[model samples]
Target: MTGAVESPFWTFVKQSVKSLFIVAFALSATSYTDDVVGSFEGLETGLSAALNTSTATTPKTTYEALDQSLGKGLDLIKICTENADAAGFNIGTAIGWLIAAAVIAFGTTLVTVIGGAVLIVSKFALAVMFAVGPLFIMLLLFPITARLFDSWFSQVLNFTLTIVILAVVMAMATTAYDAFIASVDLNSNSGESPMWAAVEIGALTGVLVWIILQISHMATGLAGGMSMAAMGIRHLMSPVTGGLSAARTAGNIINPVSTRRDLESGMMASGTRFDHMIAGNTVINPAYRQHVMQNIGKNWGWQKGGSVKN
Candidate 1:
């Protein structure tokens, strides 16, 4: 026997134990399901607080503010029209009221639709993130799978962040609406100049509409950028598909008697160059041309006019 310090059997036992320990250490390093779930929950709470949903600073949302403003503005106009009719002719006031009403109607519908769409998209993204939470936990057992899901997790996080940004924008719009209402009130209390009040109303309306449209544009751009990134990642990973196809071909070759005829016919039909035709010895024999064909398929495909595209 060789004068080795450790016998082969003992050395083998020590290596096995070391490997088992390493695997255990790796498993312990991965985050548990509860930890991941808790992290997601924390993110949700933080975002909600930041978005001013039932928060201390602002009790009303942009949508609610718009609704209330519409009602109050109509009431004030009705009262003014009554007073004007009692004093004298009110035709000018009626026409001004008609124009204001039309503007308010248009603004209300646009804001409502845009706000609802944003909410729907944000909620849907959150739902998908929750649904995939379990899959993410399962992937921790496999490092490759975990890496694959990492990009998706990041995209979901970006979407949630985008929603928060949108909320802040809407909050700004709400503030503008409040300012417009205050300005109108000031005009009413003062001399009540119709020309100045009309100008303020038009300017305020334009500001609010522009803000909502800006929000829509920013959200759309963010989503488009995310989609393009995902497509780029897909393109980068596409080369592995050829390797998988080659693996399947190798599987078929292992039991050629069962799969040989089909494989051969498929290659021939695809306009591949299969030189020799034989049933007994030729089919049973592993020809150099067959190996060449296998390698060719791995890197190239047959095209029209007997050409190859790589």
Candidate 2:
């Protein structure tokens, strides 16, 4: 006899349980989204404060701080030029001082302009990512699409860290310029040309460009490493979607009716016989082997028919 039908009461209870689970999931997602948005805002604000360059301004943004630092650098260059001119040297010495000032100004301007452009672009990219981040977070509900979220998050973190690193470098450069300006002795006639000081400042600016480049490379490497680690953890947590099942699915799609031996034979027929050698087997195609032997004999001045020396 057929089993008794499931009770209506039990069916209602099951539906209620499912509804409860859906509500709970929705609440959790909402809470998580709020937390993530709050964290992003907080991080932005914190970066702004940490990198602020203005002593007189409260609540300055990172962009403003970097701009202020760049302005200070330009002013420092102007001061150097003015000091050089005011030294009252002869025409020859004045020309030399002008040349030194020009060099320093060019180097500093180049570094600051390029660094500022990069920072601006990074900040814009981060803002765009943040705006679209909730969509990626929602993608976390599906294991198949979780990698998209992981990639987006990794890019966001990379951009944020890059901005921080560049800001710190700019701030350091500003401090160094301040120190250099303070230590300048325009009146000292100790037989040392002030052009040397200008040269040193120019060299420092050149080093700043290198430092910024290294920081970008470091940020990219760290982001790649973190993304790889996150992918590994995700794969471990999702064995059905990420491991042997995925490999089997891929294999089936690529070669639905071909067995492993069939694939190997096809590869061998396609001139991939070297794969056997790479696998530590002595198998080699006769034509390929003969060609290599002929080349070796010819290069070593041996007869092609035998190994005898020519």
Best by TM-score: 2
- Number of the top-ranking candidate, with lDDT as the measure: 2
**Tens digits of per-residue lDDT for model 2 on 213-287?**
787777777777774554532443454335545776676576443211112232322213344444332325454
**Candidate 1 lDDT, 1-310, residue by residue in tens:** 4665465544444445544533443344344234554565566557656667564545254345445545544554554454444434556755554455445545545654665566567668777875665555445345456554555556566556556555565665556566666666422235554545556655665665566556545655665456444443234334554565576577557634322333444442221123233332234456634754666657466554765589
Minimum summed lDDT over a 10-residue window in model 2 is located at 258-267
Tell me model 2's lDDT, rounded to 2 decimals: 0.63
Give per-residue lDDT, candidate 2, residue 126. 85
Where does candidate 1 stray beyond 4 Å? 1-38, 47-57, 60-89, 136-147, 186-310
Count the clashes in each prediction.
0, 0
State TM-scores per candidate.
Answer: 0.46, 0.57
TM-score of 1: 0.46
